[model samples]
Target: MITAADYEQLFAHAPCGYLITDEKWLITAANATFLAWTGYTSDDVVGTFLARMMPMGDRLLHTTRSVPQMQLTGTVSEVSLEIVDASGKPRAALLTATRSVNHDGGVEHRVIIFSAHERRRYELELVSARRRAEESEARSVRAEAGLQHLALHDSLTSLPNRAGLALILERGLTGRAPGASIAVLFVDLDHFKSVNDSLGHNAGDELLTVVAQRLSSTLSSAGTVARLAGDEFVVVEHVGSATDATVLAERLLEMVNRPLEIEGLEVVCSASIGIALADDESSEPEKLLRWADIAMYRAKARGRNTWEVHDPSEVDPAVNRMRLLGELRHGIEGGQLRVHYQPRMTIATSVISGVEALVRWEHPTRGLLQPAEFIDLAEESGLIRELGAWVLDAAVQQGAQWSRLGDGNAPVSIAVNLSARQLADPQLACMVQASLTRYGFDPSLLTLEITETALMENPVMARKVLTTLKALGVGLAIDDFGTGYASLTYLKEFPIDELKIDRSFVSGLGTSDGDCAIVSSCIQLAHAVGIRAVAEGVETDYQRSTLLTMGCDLAQGFHYSRPLAPELLEDWITAQPPSVASGRAAGPGPAHAEPDDDVEMLAAV
Candidate 1:
């Protein structure tokens, strides 16, 4: 509705400066506002390259960066620049530009400039204020002592994790009074795995969530409750005496003992509690956590739904460890350690592909102990090297014996776990070669499995070690594959033949969308890299079917069979069809063992 003259007036006197330039950035036209802002007449700016009016920093950005970008992309926006005015003073400006072709077939640029002096000053002031406030808050936080970060929180329960619990211990120790002591309570749920096995993992997760809420609400702010792992939680607080700690633990037991409705079923799950009190000012964090753990196990040993307090007047954990170490050395010499084999199946062919060797300690009085009970101890005490060697030699000898079964016997590979400590030794390859030679076992029939986390710890060193072992012609596998942060890049880099998907993800195959996607991607990734993908800890029929559909090459878990004595495994094999017994099964086994033991999940094998 406005006249042509009115439009002309608006362009000349617009709030921001406007200019037209040829492809070379030589100004062909400029609005009156542009000349006024620069304190220059038409004669001073017309026919001059825009770069000449910019400072060195902005000149380079305009010509070398912004101009080229606009020419290619057709636009550039909000580029902050410092321009030189007629008086040779620098002015802060925000620039926006666009490129187009004129009717005469020549390229032209339309440039818009906004004076940013006041806005830039305001932004600087705001940034300065923010930094000062942060500094003051940080100083106050430091005065209050160690505080756990939000990142330390668990994703599932929103409770603090193991690392956060350490910080809580630190802060608690720092503020303790003269003679007063602090207590760490270890809480472990009893028969928790039954919930998972019966109602599935979803119900198990719900029960855990409810328990976390109950514990947090019961303690309020008096104590800190942290989830150490699946069914383990730790409570840290200041207490006057051992008696007081006992009272607190009783309250906790009551809270956990209450029946709750999970998945439409009323479930009564109780906890065993272990309390460790440290009165010494110099007590280490590891000492307290370990003592609490040992006490918790004692409570479990006595019976569930009870509490036990660690008393130094009795056996010390460290002393007990040393004694146990000595006993283990004798146990090894006395032939007390036993090797059990868990069968692994070829998913596609239904063939009994191989068996993984799992070690068990026949601790005279302690009966049979799982690897979890003492593997960490052996590793820390530097005895794993000996333990590992024993397992390797024993497994190789056993494999050689099976190999002599002669014709029609399906060839079976024996897989042995290699601990991180063993992998670091320069002589590991030599030991492997020696074992193969002594037993006359086929190098191609032996598979060595290393955990993904262990391999990624010191990759350069792991690669050097793994390369040496690979030269011996044995297969290599990345155990617990999907649990750690390892990528396909490293997967391809390592000379591994198989990827064992971690059981944590496999368990959720029928329920968790995220887990299913991860499992599928892992299988595809392994296939793409020309490696076989295996799933570990598969229990349900649904999980097995899902993995089969995804083309998993191998699998092992309680769904097939628990690790058994050699003679028992032989019986199990004899019960199978002739095809299965010959390791050339034409179809899947008629049935696999489904165990009722709630503690089977805790077994590393």
Candidate 2:
């Protein structure tokens, strides 16, 4: 319905700018709006190149671009642009082009242009908003990633933590191909506590970080290195055979055995490496980890700075331990686990003051199992929590039963061992109290033995637990006192009532001057703090005499009697001369035994 006059009016009065260009894209005609958009007059653009209207950067885009059917279609898609305005400032724009063709004259190409100032402004704002949104989203993602890393990494060494290691272990085990074999190596640094104690925690941290870096750097192709926690690092390798695993493990040992320089101090630490091999069928995180840990302990026992591969066919203590853990859980429900009393005699008075309640697993198929056979397994499997509670309940019940029986004048106290895992349990204090109340035994008659290592693991927590136990009037003794990394500085840190000199030192009292010195110092240390010293494994007269001379308060070993059932101990006590039974029962000659008390005690007991 439009005429030429109407078309002309529409072009002139249109809200958007309009323009016409020839085949060469030269500006042949333009409307007032178009002229105003570029801060140019009709005269200025009449014969000017269309390139002149655009910025130099956009001119190249314009020249090389195809302006298809702008005349035929009479409209073009929107395009963004930046052009110089009246003040020579860059103004944002959106451009659309249409084409017109003249038929009367020789075929001439013509194009129409529309200005989009408001549209370009909106687009620019949107771009800016999008950039900000992207930046914020990126920042949020990074923050979440950092939090996840913190949750699964060690703060000290900046290495994967136990949780992270577990994740990797799970992946390594499950992602293996049908025949793919994985080698898991558990590396433990030797004497790391000595470094922490002597050189300070900062130095220890520095050494661990350096060690972590070394462990990472030393990993061969297709291996992953992670710090499981503390001074322990784990290496997982996709290897072919046992020999390959052995080679990698040896290489790792050599790498970690090197001395490290930390804070201008030379710190030397050896490593114990344990390797467990896994195939698709037998691979699992907990199983592999436990086997590797067992192998690592084996390496440590053989001496550090060495590597040991797990022999699946070999009678691994860890397998037995895992079995024991399973058994312990069932034992509680099935009522197969029982408390066996090992009487602790007074050195000055041979009469029993207490009976250490040792845990015995009466396996239906496997005869009676000693604690040595499963205690370490319990510690490793985190089953110590349940085992410790059982011991507490069983010991308390037996103590109360004995109290009712009343050996003549008074009842004997019952002692039990508490693993480090149990001490870390938040419910330990309440559990102990509940056990005591349930058994109706005076809390004073219950003694708990903890090794030096357990006490030092977490001093604050251990101290809190011990304090609670002491407040309940329960006795606390440091078992195997001189065997572990116990510091004298921490002796008074806990409310300790007794110190049992390790039988190792006691057995060597007469033979080794070093052992004698240890025993002497132990006795002095005990007396200095008003805590009585009980020397275990006093089999020979010489060991007993040395302990007596060094002022040991009590002694227990074969020289007295092996840990016996209550009836056997009663019979033994009844048969002995009243003087020997009530007072000190001396052992035979010092020559009749080797001075190494630990071996003798372990053998006899």
Best by lDDT: 1
Candidate 2 lDDT at 234 equals 85
How far is 491's C-alpha from truth in model 2 (Å)?
5.2
lDDT of 1 by residue, 39-143 (tens): 999988999988889878446665657867985798887777877999999998888889999889999998998778644665687999999999999988976
Badly placed stretches (over 4 Å) of model 2 are 1-16, 19-32, 35-111, 114-188, 191-205, 212-251, 274-298, 310-321, 348-353, 407-411, 421-436, 457-467, 483-496, 581-605
Full-model lDDT for every candidate: 0.80, 0.72
CA error at residue 567 for candidate 2, angstroms:
2.3
Measured by TM-score, the strongest candidate is 2
**RMSD to the hidden true structure, all candidates:** 22.9, 9.6
After aligning candidate 1 to the native by TM-score, how far in Å is the CA of 519 from where it should be? 1.3
